[model samples]
Target chain A: MSGQLLVFVICGAFAVLGALGLLFFHKAVHAALSLALVMINLAAIYAALDAALLAMAQVIVYTGAILMLFLFVIMLVGIDRRESHRELIPGQGVVAILAGIGTLGLLVFAILGSFPAQAVGLEAANGGNVESLAALIFGSYVFAFEFISALMIIAPIGAMVLAQQARLTAKKTQRERAAARIEAYAQKGVHPGTLPNSGVTALQDSIAVPGLLPAGRISTSSVSQAMVDRDAVVNVHAVSLLTAQRFAELSGEVPPAIIKPEPVDLVDTKDERELLK
Target chain B: MNPEMVALLAAVLFVLGAVGVLIRRNALVIFMCVELMLNSANLLLVSFAYAHGSLDGQVAAFFVMVVAAAEVVVGLSIIVSVYRSRRTTSVDAPDLLKL
Candidate 1:
């Protein structure tokens, strides 16, 4: 067998195995990696066929950019969620198998019946694959080429519109969030504070035990001390409304002062209580 | 090696891809299988281009790759949007239009 045939057989085997791996892998990320392997193998096949530009494009566009996008989406959406094994449509699997067999048979019949024994080689072309492809695309298929460019421009815009959370929706969500916080505070027999200032200033006073002071007084000191006092306040009201508000805004959780009882000792506690404090 | 033999292999690869697409439940896997089918077609195109001693088939294969790239962009965006809203990427999950 010729070297070209050997390369084709090896790459073809890899491509088939990669496709099977992609189909059977349980994890989406694994399946995506498998698809990448298949894409790379297909690029090799393209190179063996002497379509060098296509091989490079296959590697760069499909393997590099497109597969990266697939992996990104898989990760962003959380990859651990395995697809349910149960078929959504009853009898779909059997139907698909039959259809696949039918399609394959038809394709084979057509290939055997109509395909010429000898394919015309690329020797007639004046230049390399890239040069000839560029000439054809720019010369004969220029309109279709320009149309593809327009389609490419529109795709990103469409994706952005589809993925974007609308401003009105976000505002409504924020309002619902504020309402939930207020309801939570009401359930705990506490009044919710107003929104806090965005900027946090350092405390000037060097109080030995900042937690001893009421939450309202702590906000005037350093931001760190305010944070400490905010954590230590027994009475939800003792915590500065601002500090509590800021914490709620940042974490979407009520400050410890709002959730827990007051600690009798401020320091030197070894229990989980110190950690909580 | 004969061009007909290479064409036969491409056909097999395409059929395998089709079967995988039919059998796999994961939307992403189905997408990849579709890509496999496209690659097989590209291989056939290039093989024909080589056998026919013409540049047209290769040019056609190049166009197919461009179209496939565009398709990936749109298809992945749709998949991501679907996953975001429903938290699942199963091709069977999104059936709002089913009667």
Candidate 2:
């Protein structure tokens, strides 16, 4: 095969793969990334096809700006969003696949029947791809170009208008929140003040490490309940081991090289246990 | 490569995009499939430009890109707004139009 045909085959294969990835990936972010791959490969094919300017624009606009926008919005909407597999209409998948294959066959046949066998390459017409494109844009399609600017202006304005959230109620002040908290504390005996800060131990200083209370008990309110529920919270024994070792070193005691955290029975206050419950 | 090969590739991508639109549930993914279809069209335009040895097809492709960019911005914003109100990106969630 010729070099141009080779380029087309490779890029076209990758583009098809990427498009398939976009369809099959469960996560929105992954699908977005796959779409980006397809775009970049398509740009490569564009360059191979002698549309150098369009190739650059494809890389810059589609892969760079548009895909990034898609990613940004994906994150905004929810990056971990898994597409629900429950089809609204029964047998939609089979129907869609059949339709797609039929369309593809029809399109392929149409192209094979009508398309020119020999490509009259853009060597003479595109003396300079940039220059010729610029002339067409500035000379003939200038009015459409000007209208596109109007479209560009209107699009952003419309986006801004759509994105702005309308407030349905008055904003609450800090005092209001505090008052509500105090009322809850008085009526239901809930904690009124801010929760304890996350742990800052000698070797482990992560939010998953619960704060050490004054009585050497782990503060129930320090770590997030979500972390606790997930069993992601750092063990109190593990965090305290380093602190104990450091204290031993400070007091001129030779600490063990590998101090395995032994199970230490923590004194759980009734109120704190109730708070946890 | 001949215009037919590029046209064939574009057709495949276009069909893939159509299937994606039909089957995918996420509104954003559907929007992306729409973009894929538009890109396929742009590729065809560029290929035809090469066949005719004229710059007009490339110019048309460039216009498609501009319109596409604009469409993405507005489409994404609409998706964002819808997500905010509905708290889900599934295309089937907003079924108020369904009879």
Candidate 3:
């Protein structure tokens, strides 16, 4: 077989397989991957068909950009999304497959009936594939190319407008937020300023660790109430030890032994205390 | 391969894409099938360009690719917007107009 024919056969088989995979794959991600396979093989076939520049464009544009866009959308939409098996119409799958095969048969019949016995190859017309295509694109189809440029601009703007979520409420200004906080503070004993910053110490710098108050007690407001409810608050004993050690290092004296706080296990301890009662 | 055989292959791919569009429920999958159909058309255009010994068909195919890129951007964005409000990628989920 001629080398071109060999290229066509192999790529054609794989392209068809990939297309079928696109059809039958249950996962959207898998279907996207299969479509990418089909696109790559089609680019190979385009190369065999003497559209060398087109072949490269096919790989770069379709496989590189478009399929990646598809995969991105798939991920955004949720990769684990299942393709609904429940047909919208009864027996739609069977009917669709049969119709597709029938359409393929009709196309084959038409091609066989009308196509010439031999194709006139592009060897003479293409002095160089890139130059000739450039001549055609910039010369004859230049106006169409300009229109395409317009389309390229418009499409992204349309996409942006379509995908953008309209803001439902006006954003509050800093002054407005401060006023609201003051109003709440006047009506009820609520803290007006921002909550104390989460703890940062040598032993533990986690949000679950409450910062120490100026009075040397752990500030409850520093760690969120949610953390306390979930029993995720870090023990302050270790942090106290680290602080003493650092102080001793600075003063060149032995670190004082600090008493450990009773470990707080609010939910379990409450249940245990009830059981003991 | 002969241009005719290449034409046959393109036809097969186009039909496969059509069936995929029909059978697939996910909007993203359907969008992919439409891309497959467009790619198959590009293949046919390239093959005919080879057969006729002219670069016009290839140029046409190049135009198709550009238009397809623009179309995909708009179409995918619409799909994403629909998904955002609806929280499902199923094509049938957005059937508020259906009685």
Measured against the native two-chain assembly using Cα atoms, what DockQ does each of the candidate structures obtain, in the order listed? Answer: 0.50, 0.80, 0.72
How far in Å is the alpha carbon of B73 misplaced in model 3?
0.7
Candidate 1 vs candidate 2: the TM-score winner is: 2
Q: Tens digits of per-residue lDDT for model 1 on A1-277?
A: 8777887888888887887787678887888898888889878877877778888988998899888988888777666666788876788878987887798788888777465665555656737777888889899888888887887788777777767744333445778878888897989954467532322223222332233234223222222433443353232223334555777899998777552333333323453233234
TM-scores for all predictions: 0.69, 0.77, 0.72
Evaluate model 2 with DockQ and give the value: 0.80
Using lDDT, rank the candidates from best to worst.
2, 3, 1
Model 1 chain B scores worst on lDDT over the 10 consecutive residues at B1-10
Which of 1 and 3 is ahead in TM-score? 3
Candidate 1, residue B49: CA error in Å?
A: 1.0
Q: Give me the candidate number with maximum DockQ.
A: 2
Better of 1 and 2 by lDDT: 2
Off by over 4 Å in 1: A165-277
Question: Where is model 3 more than 4 Å wrong at Cα?
Answer: A168-277
Q: Higher-lDDT candidate among 2 and 3?
A: 2
TM-score (chain B) for model 1?
0.96
Collision pairs in model 2 = none
Q: Write the per-residue lDDT of candidate 3 for residues A204-244, one digit (tens) a residue.
A: 88888877655445666677755664567776655676687
Tens-place lDDT per residue, model 2, A121-154, is: 8998988899988999999999999999999999
Predictions in order: chain A TM-score: 0.61, 0.69, 0.61
Residue B11 local lDDT, model 2: 97
